[model samples]
Target: MGGVLADGDRVKAVVVKSWMASTGGLEVHYQDGLEKGSSLKANAIQQGLEEDVHVSGAQDMETVVHRPAKRSKVQLGSAPPLTDSARLLARRKHCRFWENSGDEMELELLAAVGRNLQPGTDSILLGTDSHTCNAGAFGQFATGIGNTDAGFVLGTGKALLKVPTIIRFVLDGEMPPYLLDLILQIIGEISVSGATYKSMEFVGSTVESLTMEERMTLCNMVIEAGGKNGVVPADETTFKYLEGKTSIDYEPVYSDAQARFFSDYRFDVSKLEPVVAKPHSPDNRALARECKDVKIDRVYIGSCTGGKTEDFLAAAKVFLASGKKVKVPTFLVPATQKVWMDVYSLPVPGSGGKTCSQIFEEAGYDTPASPSCGACLGGPRDTYARMNEPMACVSTTNRNFPGRMGHKEGQIYLASPYTAVASALTGYVTDPRDFLM
Candidate 1:
């Protein structure tokens, strides 16, 4: 099943975000092989197992994965090395994949795919994690598939998919109390299934004004609404952001004047407020004012959606302006190690105006040793930042399903960075305006 596309199929690219060695379903196959002491070549794709050392069933099949190399500059082989990838594991380790787990996983996978992703290439991402759609932010066709399908793609380097009708959303408005709440507000208007099996493309001056990290945050959640992918066409903003980030030399892609859509919506966000999703579902959203009285036992301000520099900047600004440390147990995690350091560079007003990270550390906040999607799945008994006892939390991470944060008995309310920091300061669901100086 080499790369091929039928007429009328809308997909234009493929992204493979697997072999990271931990988390998601691939963990089983990767870890099993490690336990069996099966080593791999330093630069090999397959482990050269005689009979499926770790992968079970059809995934064990042998096939040559013909990754698209139409462009000579695209890089592959960058994902975090499995613990026992080869005899040279120590020399070729890429744990960056493991460090940035849980959300926007496709971003790191792209680095491993090649040295530079050529512009104007259509691509699909094969992975079990639904957040794989995050790649669409770069103007490529990307989405998620199951583990068996991943294995098949690994062998064949091809996949079949239904062409999804495109839906367009034009955001026209000023920044809300918090820019991060914008997408959650959009989701509240359109139920999670509203865009089922369709593409949702974001455009408008408001969207163009945002940074690349913010755009990725918007595309990353398309899967949460059951959409195939979300995209922002490559433009000057995109080009400038990607300039040095990749070595690809190809034409950029964009939407056309005659492009048709299955549906369209425009939101004038001047009236938008900070909103929160009540425990249980992403679409179960409401104005933060409605839940202002709700108390919380802890606060979480990290994830692909929350870990970006702009995100932490907003939360830090809130803390600095208010001059308050959290009243609750606030867990601060940067999406990446670089981000961990970035937080320390942004000065806060408290404790003589140290960087936000220093301010939090001085105020006794719990900073996890490493950044990973450790607690976002919370069903695992040992997930970091887990709540074993009955409690309430305000998290910026996606999903609040039963036991998502390790305690079915606990409740999670999803909010923006501003609201999350405001709640942490008060130990209650809060409106940032109420605490503003």
Candidate 2:
């Protein structure tokens, strides 16, 4: 079989063709045997027809699969329909320890692969989810790709990528209680296309002070700014988070002192205040306090960006400080089963043995729901806490586009957990300082 495999020019052409084919349902196209013009087309469809293995959320459990049983047509399958031998092989490759229900895809990836990621090595992580860049916080080269690239990687365990220019953002000074505002500030300044197709490397005294979860939060939103990926160099915090998660040996990588960058920007964290992105865009920024008159009917605290354990802890801290009942319908959704367990089990730091669940209940909020993407994705009309009717909401989720949480006219204000919970208590876009002070 004389065909293209490693030649750069040939590979680029093949990749482009494959991407074009993906618009019509094919994820990848590979030619075998004599690879000349018309002859190459014969085996391309057959290659894509073969089984593919993908471990995903429950939402994709009944996804359609192409199989000959229905004339090779796409039809719903309980799993990725595979031949007997393929099924056995997939079973062997599957790791049940990495499986979890009701978790966002990026969260699952971080739990399974981030801890084992080794920088300065050939280790590469790619996924179909745009937020796959969240893994870059581990100091590894990770990025999101279309299904065509994902399929290619699935088959060959390799991908062709161009080196992206780096734009470093150096954060310094005392860290604010709410870090979401920091990212919102960057996106607001750069607009949506400021860092298109480029890597945003974060490094500074403040970044070094962040927890692993906080670092992931910073990297996760890089996609919002049209960044190819975002990275935070691995440090004691990164290693500490990996301690019980993996026993893999790895070397941490850092930018050389003399490294070149496309651009460098710095910010003083102490001068910042909680910020929010108004409805319709993630970069439509405004100070959280400035929006105090923006009455809201709901508040949501969940999603890969905001539904983590630390996110819940922040909300609990706000509620503990306020000591007031919520005036609006507040919804809570943990990002994963681990987070759900933490909400029910882990004690809030200053609450003196009170769990988040207890604090939320005392604040007149409903019990936190099970782990899932929840209303952030604007699921079915029956989705829990979905804004079935047009309403203004303060949410901890990343995006706040129209109809994102459900109703077309529904408004979403993207804020930190503290702001989200505070708004829930006041029925308006209130600042956390009102309570925390």
Candidate 3:
């Protein structure tokens, strides 16, 4: 056989496909008459391949004889047009242990770590839910595995994966103002486990127009629906967004044309309205109009989920439109310092090019350190004030489980940044529709 296998204390192989690293460092391909369950050693395999090499435990290898491609027909236009296969390869090849002390450093760390891993290493596991897929941006079949799964992967180079069904989200028309909030509302309706063990694929023409940040935001929320993973097919748009990064040879992966979807959901972005979630659960969703009279003690507008640039832009609009200071204490922490720098530089809504940093500072809102989830995840900054304080808070973070935002007694409302900013001005949950118009 042309395939080279080397044997030592452990087994290793030189495989043509780099992504196969997850399959225990051995490449299984059709070349010559090789029987299943064949053994190869670390030194037997040929060296000097264009791609990187990997090693795995001897027990990790498996063979499925003569199985046809899992799916038959291929689906076109189902993936985002902007995927960089080469970059994904670079990220999987390199592995390192580096601490990200600050927000800017964290992003750099993530990028650097991504660049170091070789494609096809045992699937990477992450503690986070949404951003875990960012590694997928590098093409290593990465996913946000829970704590237990992560533990298992760390110990053994194998994970028991059940191929998940796919949920196709076909987006049409332009996204309305405050689109993230709207997306959250749709997600809320599905509850936390609606898509459990399923692949959430975002498709349609409108997806091409969204920025990488926007696509990431959507993909990141797959966990909210209890999905195993979310993906956007790589396209030209993906390439443009990833320009100037290290390059690797890549090919976009898509659903088979004859691929059967477990279900389909359709949305016309142009018709979406601002949405919010009631206290204690991401699924407790309602239009902001429904919660108009709820008073609040704190209004928080930042988190991994809500701390992006578009989020701040939406919040700024509402703040400027209110033409007033926030009635209650408002906490705004950027997801990372990079996001803070971006939002801080933008001029306040009505001010003649005055930046938000000046406007917020002058208005008395507290700007905490970067890379802090702060009050969003029961962090130290804002604990529940009083048992019956009747205080309401609007935030963009995911999950509203009791005691999630500091105090069990405090009432927390989940909304997009726009709604949160509007409510902060009035000290109550107010509908964003009135301000958007």
Candidate 4:
């Protein structure tokens, strides 16, 4: 159960027991002992499994696992490790579609897929952009590809290769209250370009402790630090989180016996406090207390990054604390239609089947709209039109570029869904920690 599942390999079998809907998709329950099923089915069953069963899926379906291949600890330094293989790999898989299209419209058209077909035509490109990694949830080896590498992939199907040195940030301890906000702040400090061309593997006691919603929040940010991909080795936590939710088999990815990493960073959850990122960048890391006075015009708490069930739950927590109407225009756009349905309609633990929209409306904010890329992609809903008026927005989207939300003059701040809710209530950049108690 702890080892990696190879492609096309069957490890065990489990019987279907029940069904549950997740942000990812429909999941099915299985008895604790069966070993073979579709990876998608496995994901669903993994979430529903109350008892253990044998499970089987493809090697590609396995979630990469991380174990310390070497015992020596390495200190953090200014420069990242140099690796030829990772660089080559990045070059080989850059975006070819954007290259083929000369204009934005063409690129958008290429992104669209037929309703019944798989969106991934072949290999996919990754971006620090939140939407870039959405393809992976659909079962593609998709990740964010940088401008340099994107150019190469666009020009040629293959980019250069330099196998990344892995750095596993394991999760063992319980996440502090509103920990999702803390993750965004940490990633903010790492910057959208920090892990450029690196493989950032998440492994630790704390990682093993998080729910799938929480882990996805972490993995979703791999591109934020410029890393090629952020992965968690499949474990009990992962399997349980994903069980009964995905048909995809839950396989684990293990590092090679000789796997090498340039450095490792560890965080003690017990010592962590709530955090927030200032406007206009996901990298503007700061203590939430330091930026409480900053006023804002909009607070958006949804996107692929922060629009999941866990995200909605976090926002609801903040709304409960504020105990009033939001002062500003706060928009909650679920990442996908499925997510919207679950949070707004589906019955689940904690939710008691109350939709997120019902919660928000009860809390005095506008009910959320249907799913879309929305602010993350500068779409129609809640876009910035005026510039230089000092409008502050706390969004769950990844990038906060000059015109990312709309007008070049509008300012955008990146944070987790919880932070957005806090700001929405206060009409300013408010820290989530103050409400935790």
Q: What lDDT would each prediction earn against the true structure?
A: 0.66, 0.74, 0.59, 0.55
lDDT: which is higher, 1 or 2?
2
Clashes of each: 16, 0, 43, 94
**lDDT-based ranking:** 2, 1, 3, 4
- Report the number of the highest-TM-score candidate: 2
Give candidate 2 regions above 4 Å deviation. 1-97, 101-115
- Candidate 2 lDDT over 1-437, as tens digits, reads 34422212121112223432322322323322213222112112223333332222222323333222212222222333333234334444452123223333453246323554665456766767888888888887778899898667656667888889999999999886755567888998887889999999999998998887888788888999999999999888777777776666778878898999999999998888888999889999989889999999989998888888999999999888878999998999988777888999999998999999999999988789987788987989999999999889999888887888999899999998988998998999988888887
Global lDDT for candidate 2? 0.74
Among these predictions, the greatest lDDT belongs to 2
Q: What is residue 98's positional error in candidate 4, in angstroms? A: 21
In order of appearance, the predictions have TM-scores of 0.74, 0.78, 0.69, 0.63
**Global local distance difference test of model 3:** 0.59
What is the overall TM-score of model 1 with all chains considered together?
Answer: 0.74
164-250 in candidate 4: lDDT tens per residue?
Answer: 766656445777776675456557656777777676776777776666666556766677677766665555554444444445333
Inter-residue clash pairs, candidate 2: none
Please rank every candidate by TM-score, starting with the best.
2, 1, 3, 4
Comparing 1 with 4 on TM-score, the higher-scoring candidate is: 1
